[model samples]
Target: MDAIERDDDDIEFVETAYANVAEFVEQLLLPTYRRNPAKHRWDPRWWEYQEVAMRLEALWRSFEYLRLEGPTGMAVFFRDYLDPTMRELTSENGPFWRLDKLGDERGVPDAWPSESPPRNMF
Candidate 1:
């Protein structure tokens, strides 16, 4: 049987990072949460929070670069792409969230599917 041994330290980093991200989301989304569910729209305000989450994730990914020096990488895409749009939105009394510069590259995707077959089904 092939088994995977998990490292508690890595898991701890992931857990802590996840908790931080959740807190960020909650703070940014509280306003929207107060509105009726069905009345939700693709308002600029919502996107501001989304961008903030992206930047936060990027900040977390930057930690990986610190421990592993194998490759050149940066997670500033979220800020790069969204900042201009957000700035424009906010300039005219539109909703927006000001996210710190995350850099030129965006953070990696939030989720990835397993490559292996299902357990006991293969």
Candidate 2:
């Protein structure tokens, strides 16, 4: 969550930042989304997008609170938030909540792509 732990490649931040970024995701973000799926709905990807967007205002506040700007801010956003959510969304056992929520008594999951929940998500 702080600055990259190791910046071996000053020329390419991503290269040097990779390990630190993975560590950040695995350590902080991953736990929130992975171990505790209800902490956030990351399955089905879009739900995670929706959840993140719903908190966009807060995220922006965080962006400002952290005194981040431009690319650095974006990287922080990914490192602290998006990356872990993505991992959960794409996990082998992903979409857990989504699957759990679906398949009423009939036992047939609703693959309906009608609209985002809490409708009018825009």
Best by TM-score: 2
* Candidate 2 clashing pairs, residues 3+ apart or interchain: none
**Cand. 1 TM to true fold:** 0.22
Measured with C-alpha atoms, the lDDT of residue 32 in candidate 1 is 30
lDDT of each: 0.36, 0.43
Cα lDDT of candidate 2 equals 0.43
Model 1, CA-based lDDT: 0.36
Please report how far candidate 2 places residue 63 from its true position, in Å: 7.8
Query: Can you write out model 1's per-residue Cα lDDT over 1-122, one digit (the tens) per residue?
Result: 11112355442322232244445334532443243323222232333355545654554344333323334322242344334433443342223222222222223224447688788985
Give the Cα-based TM-score of candidate 2 against the true structure: 0.27
